[model samples]
Target chain A: MAESYRRSRWSNALFVAPYLVVFFALLVFPLFWGMWLSLNKVDLFGGGQFIGLRNYARVLSDPVFHQAVRNTVVFVAVSVPTLVGLGLFLALALNKTTRGSSFLRGLYFSSSILSVTIVTLIWRIVFIPNDGLMALIFNVLGLEPIGFLSTKGWSLFSVGVATVWWCIGLPMMLLLAALQQIPADLYEAAALDNAGKWRVLTRITLPSIKPTIMLVAVIQIVMQFQLFGQALIMTNGGPAGSSRPIVMYIYETAFIRWDVGMGAAASELLFVIILCAAMFQYWISSRKEVA
Target chain B: MADRSAFSPENLTANRTLFWIAAVLAALMLAPVLWILGLSLKNNQDLMHGTDAVFRAPYTLKNYADILVNSQVFGWFLNSLIVATGQTLGVLTLCSLAGYAFARLEFPFRRAIFIIVLFGLAVPEQAVIIARHQMFNWVGLHNTHIALMLPGMSSAFGVFLMTQFFNAIPKEIDEAAMLDNTSQFRIFWKVLLPLTLPAQATLGIFTFLLAWNDYWWPLISATKKEMYTLTIGIASTQTNFAQSEGLGFLSAQAIFASLPVVIVYIFFQRHIVTAVSGGAVK
Candidate 1:
């Protein structure tokens, strides 16, 4: 029996070998390398000095880093709630309907499949000044055409709007699935109790889908903090760096500025922030589970 | 108590209003896509002018012709196809093995390792891109397809999904296979993998779309024009073709770039929907 157990153990090792190799090589190795690179003054073509927290100290003093932090905070503060709230609202609306609901759900969720690049490009056109869709709409309303993408104040907001439109689909689909899982009889009971739509949703539906909602919120927060593609493709974090996200700043520092050390330092900072957020999520989720 | 009876005027009005509202919202969701299709067929002059001539604009195949003829668009398309397909296959093989192990194996430090793997899901590729470039350079794999495929082959999301699915499978099946003297690897190959089609399909579609649409890594790593993927190619076109007043052709190129994924989506939307919804559940 012990020999058979040993054989099974060997088999388990063999089964897991391929995955562990790839995982270590691709994910784990680069992560450690990033941590090490963050410490040193590394160059693009090779050769580096061991700076030892100098890069980190420089990042702390940089005004651009501060701006990136502010922008990221603003982005998360505005975008995450909007995305989850809008998604939930749409899911609720669609859940009540019986006719063509499946088709509508598919239509609503389809945009989630489009890449960030395509979404940003399409919206860049839509948000263009003077001759774009927003211009056409304002002209119809007899208002002056707003420079949505080019203006300083409107740039981040415009990007946020486009992001909200693009990202609402997945959360919407997830909420819809969760809503579907709640039994029909619960709603029927709520109706029998003379509860209004609002009450039923608050008392019955909300509590039932609390876990899913929390999961969606956590995922959205993580994703929003990593917002880079839209800023890169659409605005290039322009209009005097008003829309520059932390990730974009990291990319610019490394690639455009050729300051690999500074970029690595910034990446490490971003990594810490993301790690804290993830830990917070884990803590909250586990606490809930235990409760 | 509210009456459950039908045929009430208020109920009828509410139903009709809700239906129309939902229908309008659905149409609004599709408006951007329709607008893109409209722009693709128009001339550069028509596109800039923002005239209602979008529909009445002389429909020409010149844009499509140019994309097909003038640029290295086809080469980029082929590059994206090869990379995406290769990455999909790699992720399937690797993630499934790892996922099955995580689900079924009773190894020492199993939970600890699984937690470490979960941590990977939170590590965005963009964060470590500089280091990834450094490592690739060191290994002499920079600018190669292997550079593209390597990072994608180890997907946290794929492992997460597959593990969730694998965990749902009964353990008796593995034991039954063992009693018949089948190897563990063979059991995974012949028994578990067949049941994993839905999960595999989900990961396959997602990985394909991701690798196909990846811009940053390709933009940085693939300095050569010949090595450009679809996203990089479109971006280069938008930047380089800025002077030619060739919005129509550019839009057409964008359309062409997005077409393969769009067609695949349309054909396999049911599978995609199931997968996405299934993913949400887990």
Candidate 2:
């Protein structure tokens, strides 16, 4: 009996071991190894010698790294709010259980289903000066077609626009799920008080779903921080590399330039920036809740 | 006053306004996709003429045919299918096992290990991507679909998701199975696993979509042309076509690349939404 009992307990370890092997090797191992690599001058093809903090120092001084960091921040700042805010507003409008609510939800969510390749490709076609969708609209209005992808100033912003369109669905669906969870009685009570729509939204809807809103916002920031393929495919981080995100910079650094240490350091820098954003969000949201 | 409640003039106007708002928003959202479809149907001569020329005459699917005949679109599609399916299956099995163990079994240092997995959740791929690439290359898995499938197969999110689901199953079921002299494996496989289909579906859809739509990791790992997944393949095709194949070629390729996920989304829309929102709330 005792032997069989011991066997079962050990068997439980067997079940988890397969996952842990991969987990340790790919995730935990890489995590620490990357940290170590960040400190040294890593030679991908050969041996590496430790040169503490130099890679981080280089990242701080590199103009392209600075540009990538700035560009990533700009993307997260603009795109995160647009996606989260637009999703929340749309979710509110669509949560009323009207006939079109479900259909409209799917409509808004369709673009999100597309792969990044498809999303970028579609926008690439649309952003073409005289032959794209915007062009069609511009031609109708008898206006000059904007060089959406061609111009240096407009490139990053255009990438953000495409991202916003692709991303709104996830947050919208999340906020909608939270909305569904809100007790209908609260709304009935607000209605009994003859509260207007704005009052109901502020006092009832927003407050009730505040946690979810924060969740959506935090996740949005985290996801947006890792932006790579969009600008890579759409702009190739171009028009003077204005749209180059930090991840793209890291990719080019590590793989293209084969500067593993410098790339790892930049990766660590991006990780810290994302962590700071998440922490900042929590701090602000918690303070707001208390207030 | 009772009669005033149902069809008040104010409510009627608000309803009309809401309808217009929803209609315009829907149009804005769907217009780009429809415009892309229209653009994809236009031939190169039509595309170069102007935006208006597309609507007038000369539709052609020669671009689509040219791509299908000329390039490895189907090969990329098949590769994407293989990796996405393989990764999803591997992740589902591994995560469910680990999740069940954590949720059901009493073990040493389980909490510590689970915390590490949570850290994995917080750590984005960009954080560890360089080392991951190096490690994979060191293991001789570079330029292979296995490399793409391997890193994603052991996801923290998947483990967490499955753990939550396993925790929700009544402990009495496990106890009853134990009382019946069943081993832990049997209890897990027979008693608990069958009950977590909803969680499995959600996680499966989420994983499949993620693996299919993955761009960056695949872009690096699958450097060889034949090994490229749909994303890397289509991205290259888009640029290559920019100079050679024209706007219609790019649009057609975009549509073709989009077809699989779009079909999956239309069918399993609820599952996708639930998985995302569920993961978010946690």
The sequence of per-residue lDDT tens digits that candidate 1 reaches over residues B3-31 is 65432212322244555676797797677
Clash count, candidate 1: 0
Clash pairs (backbone) in predicted model 1: none
lDDT of 2 by residue, B1-282 (tens): 345443331231124456468769888877778887877788876667565666766688887787778658889888999999999999999999999998887566778878888777777888878889888888889888789899998679899989999999988777777777887888889989999998899999999999999888898889999999988888876655434247776777778788888889889887887787665432
Give the number of the best model, judged by lDDT: 2
Q: Which one wins on TM-score? A: 2
Per-residue lDDT tens digits for candidate 2, residues A222-282, read 8898898889888889989899999999999998899999999999988897888777766
For candidate 1, write residues A175-238 as lDDT tens digits. 8778777766676766666677566667888888798788789878988998888887777787
The lDDT for every candidate, in the order shown, is: 0.77, 0.82
Per-candidate TM-score against the hidden true structure: 0.92, 0.93
Could you tell me the TM-score of candidate 2?
A: 0.93
lDDT for position B199 in model 2: 89
lDDT of model 1 at position B17 = 52
lDDT of 1: 0.77
